[model samples]
Target: MPTAIIAEDEDLLRSELRRMLAECWPELEVLAECEHGADALEAIERLQPDVAFLDIRMPGLSGLDVAHAVSGRCHAVFTTAYDQYAVEAFAAGALDYLLKPVAKARLEQAVTRLRERLRLSETAPDIGRLMAELDRRLRPQVETEQRIRWISASVGDTIKLFPIEQILFFESDEKYTRVVSGEDEAHVRKPLRELVAGLDPEQFWQIHRGVVVRAEAIARARRDELGRITVELRGRPERLKVSQAYAWRFKAM
Candidate 1:
C-alpha cells in the first residue's frame, strides 16, 4: 500500500477529502494531514510518505515551495481552484492537479494515475518550468471598476458588506487585514493581493506592501530625518510608512 499525506487549509474540505480517500482508495494509507505548508513540510520529512496532496496556496510557504523542498522523497498532487495556474502546473510536468471542490470522477482518475506511476519507477515530475511560468503571469492585474462582490468580514455578531468605494484604506496589523472607512474599521479575510486585484489602481495606490491607501484620502506626505517616509491621513494621527517601492506615489502628497 502506498503512503500519502494531505495538506490543505480548509477544515470541511479536508475532512471531506479524507472521507473520500478512505472510501475510494482503501489500500492507500494516509500517514499524515496538515493545515499549512510549514506543517506539511515537517510531516513529509518525518513520515516520508509516498505521496502528498498539497494545496498550491497556503499562509506561510507556498505548496510549490514545499514540493521543491521534498523532491525525491515523495510524489505530489496539487489542489487549487484557480484555473490560470493550471498551465504553469502542466509546464512543471506535475503528476496531476485536482481542482477545488474536487469531483469524484477526477479523484478516481488521479488515483489511477498514481497507481500506474507506482508500478513504473519514474522520478517525481519536474516543476521548475511551471513555477517560472507562474512567476511570469502571477503579478496582480488591476481592474478598472471599483466594487465589492462578496465580503468576508465581521461586524459585531454578524458579517457585513460595504462597497469598495466606502473603504478609505486597507491596513495590515499582525494577522488581520483591517478595512478602514471614515471613522470605522472592519476586519476581512481577503489578503492584500486578493484585495488589490479587485481595487482600481487609479483610486488605490499600494503605498506599502502592508498598506493600500485611498488616493483621495491622503492629506500629505513627510520624510523623517533618517530618510524614512511617512504619510499622514486627514483624520488619523497614526502615520503609514512608505516603502521605497511605493515612494513615487507620494510625490503628489
Candidate 2:
C-alpha cells in the first residue's frame, strides 16, 4: 500500500482531510498527520512517505519551505487559500494545487494522478517553478493607507472598541483571539491568520503560530545561547517566542 502524510495547521481541517482520504483511498496508508510545517518536515524526513499533502501557509517552515528543503524526495500536493494570482501561477507552472475546503471530487482526481505516477515509477514534480511563483506572490507589498484603525473586541457581555495605536499584541486562543493593550485584554472571534491579513505587515509582525506583536511595541529581540529567539515588548512582562520561519524578520536587529 502507498504511504502518505497530511500536514495542516487547523485541527478541524486536518481531521477532515484524513477522513476524506480514508474514503477516497482506502488502500492508501496514512503514515502521519502533522499540525505545523516544522513537524511535517521532520515526519517527511523520517518516514519518507510516498506522498505528502502540504498546506501552503504554516507556523514555522511553511509547505513551500518543506518542499524546497526536501527537493522532490516525495510526491507533493499543495493546499492553499491563496487568490487568483497564485492559482494562475500554479496552473501555468503545472503544479498540483488543491484549494482550501478541499472538494471530494478534486481529491479523488489527485489520487488517480498519484496512483498513475506511482504505478509508472515517474519522478517527482519539478517544484522549483512552483516555489518561484510562491515567492513572487508572498512578497510583502506595503498597504499603508488600508491599515486597521480600530479593533472591536468582546469584553464579557459588552463590546469595546480599541484604537489600533493602543493595541500591543494579539494572541490566538482556541477559536478566538485575545487582544492585549497595556494592562487590558479582550477576546475576539477572529483568528490570528485573518487578523494578520488586514493588519499592516510593517506595523505588526507575526512572531509565532499564535502570536502577532506590534513592531513599535517591541522593546527588543533576545536570542539565548541555544539560539532560541524571543521578543520582549515594551511594558509587557511576557516574552513572545519567534518561530524559525519568521526569524528572518529580526536578522538585522
Candidate 3:
C-alpha cells in the first residue's frame, strides 16, 4: 500500500483530512501526522513516505519550505487558504494544490491525479517557479495605509485603544488575543490570524503559532542546548518560544 503523511497546524483540519483520506484512499497507509512545519520536515525525512499532504501556511517551516527541502523525494499535495492568484500559479506549474475546507469532490480529483502520477512514475513538479510566484503574491506590498495603526482591546469593562507602535506583543488566548504594551495588557476579540494579516510583517514577527511580537521590542534571541530558539522582549521577563520554521527570521540577530 502507498504511504502518506499529513502536516497541518489546526487539529480539526488535520483530523478532517485524515477522515477524508480514509474514505477516498482506503488502501493508502498514513504513516504520520504533524502539527508544525519543523515536525513535518523531520517526519518526512525519517519516514520518507510516498506522499505528503502539507498545509502551506504552518507554524515552523511552512508547507512550501518542506516541499522545497524534500523535492523529488515524495509526491506533495499542498493545502492552502490563499486566494485565486496562488491557485492559478499552482495550475500553471502543474502542481497539486487543495483549497481550504477541502471539499470531497476536489480532494477526489487530487487523489486521482496523484494515483496517475504514481502509476506513471512522473517527476515532482518544479516547485522553484511555483514558490517564486507564490512569494510574489503573498509578500506584503509597499502600502503603508494598509498597515494597522490602532488596536482596540477591552481593559476590564472599558475599551482602550493603543497605537500600533506602543504594542509589544499579541498572544492568542482560548477565544481571544491578549495585547500587551509596556506595562498594560488587554484582551481583544480578534484572532491572531486576522491580526497577522493586517499588521505589518516587517514590524511584527510571528515567533510561534500563538505569538506575534513587535520587532523593536525584541531584545535578543537565544538558542538552547537543543538548538530551540527563544526570543526575549525588551523589559519583559518572559522568553517566547520560537518554532524552527520561523527561526530563520532570528538567524541574523
Candidate order, lDDT descending: 3, 2, 1
* Residue range 1-253, candidate 2, lDDT tens digits: 8999999999999999999999999999999999889899899989999899988888877776576556667878888777332432232222367888899998887787677657545453664564555435532232234557899987778989989889999999999999999978898998876777667666787777788899999999999998789999899898899876567667786
Residue runs of model 1 more than 4 Å from their true location after superposition: 122-253
Name the best candidate (by TM-score): 3
Error (Å) of candidate 2 at residue 177 is 0.8
Q: What is candidate 2's local distance difference test score?
A: 0.77
> What would the per-residue lDDT of candidate 1 be over residues 4-65, giving only the tens digit for each residue?
99999988888888888888799999988899888998999999888888888887665765
| TM-score against native, each model | 0.49, 0.53, 0.56
> Considering TM-score, where higher is better, how would the candidates rank from best to worst?
3, 2, 1
Evaluate all candidate structures by whole-model CA lDDT and list the values in order. 0.73, 0.77, 0.78
Q: Distance (Å) between predicted and true CA of 120, model 3?
A: 21
| lDDT of candidate 1 at residue 201, scale 0 to 100 | 61
| Candidate 2's TM-score | 0.53
Clashing pairs in 1: none
